[model samples]
Target: MYGWIWRHLPGNAWLRALISLVLTLAVVYVLFQYVFPWAEPLLPFNDVTVNDQ
Candidate 1:
């Protein structure tokens, strides 16, 4: 999968690296800004219980 993307990216090694870095940052931003917030409430990470014994 990664190899395919690298092959499909335009230009030489330096250009490909720059584009790949930008694409990775964009994906991270989108996931944190939108996807994670939407999915967070459905997850049980906030669930907490304390028992006194």
Candidate 2:
């Protein structure tokens, strides 16, 4: 998969590196801004816990 992306990206080494960095940051930004928030409630990572009564 990574090889596929690396191949699909245009340009030589320097430009490819820059574009790859930008694409990575954009993916992270989208996940944090949209996907993570939407899935937050469904995740079990909150600080709260309940003891069986």
List lDDT for all candidates, in order. Answer: 0.99, 0.94
As a TM-score, model 2 comes out at: 0.80
Tally clashing residue pairs in candidate 2: 0
Q: RMSD in Å for candidate 2, one decimal?
A: 2.6
Best by lDDT: 1
For candidate 1, write residues 17-49 as lDDT tens digits: 999999999999999999999999999989999
Clashes of each: 0, 0
Provide the lowest-lDDT 10-residue window in model 1: 44-53
Clashing pairs in 1: none
lDDT at residue 29 of model 2 (Cα atoms): 100
Give me the displacement of residue 38 in model 2, in angstroms: 0.4
Evaluate model 1: give its TM-score. Answer: 0.96
Give the per-residue lDDT digits (tens) of candidate 2, residues 1-53. 98999998999989999999999999999999999999999988886888999
TM-score for each predicted model, relative to the true structure: 0.96, 0.80
